[model samples]
Target: MPSPEPDDLKRLAERIDEAERKHAQRKKPPPPTSLGIAFRFATEMVSALLVGGGLGWGIDWAFDHWSHLQTRPWGMVVMFVLGAAAGIRNVMAAAKELNAEMAAKDLEK
Candidate 1:
């Protein structure tokens, strides 16, 4: 077999270096728009509320049927409030993350 040409090897090394540079430079995802942020917050809150309410409903049903206890509306109400608190917490966490991201971008510039 013939040995590779030096010119050919040089070109190949340059191409490999270019490709590596391109690969190393990752594209960041676009920041969320205001509407997107709003939707995210809303979804978080609604999903939490639904999960909490469902759990409460299940608890009430189980107590009423299995143990001769009646929880009914009170259980639902308490769970709903807890769910609201959880949702608020989620929103705050999301907001903090976004703020940090924004600060990072600002620092980069």
Candidate 2:
């Protein structure tokens, strides 16, 4: 068999270097998005508030619509307060969850 030329050896050396570089490289995962986390947090907080208010309104309607019943918007007012509390609670929970996730990621690194 004929020996390889100088040009061929140079090309082979370049290919080996390229292969070694690729072998030494590691794949990095993409970071989690803050927008998505914020959206979920907001959604949880808002939905809790909305659902609480809605249920309160429903109770108020039931009381008013019944015969021989006289109740002011007190149900709505009370429910509104409860809903606000629930929203606050949900927001706190979301914050805790996010913090935990971040802590876990830091530990990973």
Candidate 3:
């Protein structure tokens, strides 16, 4: 039935602020480690290669079986190169994003 004292109010506000700060920190995700980044890049590259090779193999098979054309290994080779390029591009983009994140974090500090 009584109002809170001034000291109690100030302490309560400080506690609330501290709790909010801790909550905010908990909500933030941890930064990626170097090993994690490397693995991500490798996974991207390998997945791209697999997709390109699979598509190329399918194309070669279709051509060989349905028509007179003979793509054989050339299709796989060319697609593989394209996949490599795509993988490289993806890595570059990821690197750029990480750089931006780092810069932002640095600025925050």
For each candidate in turn, the TM-score is: 0.76, 0.65, 0.74
lDDT: worst 10-residue window of model 3: 22-31
Q: By the TM-score metric, which is better: model 1 or model 3?
A: 1
For model 2, the superposed segments whose C-alpha errors exceed 4 Å read 1-31
lDDT for each residue of candidate 2 in 52-94, tens digit (9 for 90 to 100): 7788888888888884565557777788789888988888988
Answer with 1 or 2, whichever has the higher TM-score. 1
Error of 3 at 79 (Å): 0.3
Q: List, residue by residue over 9-85, the lDDT tens digit for candidate 1.
A: 89999999999999899888897899999999899889889888887888888888899678997788888888888
Candidate 2 — which pairs collide?
none
Candidate 2 lDDT (Cα, 0 to 1): 0.83
Q: Give model 2's TM-score versus the native structure.
A: 0.65
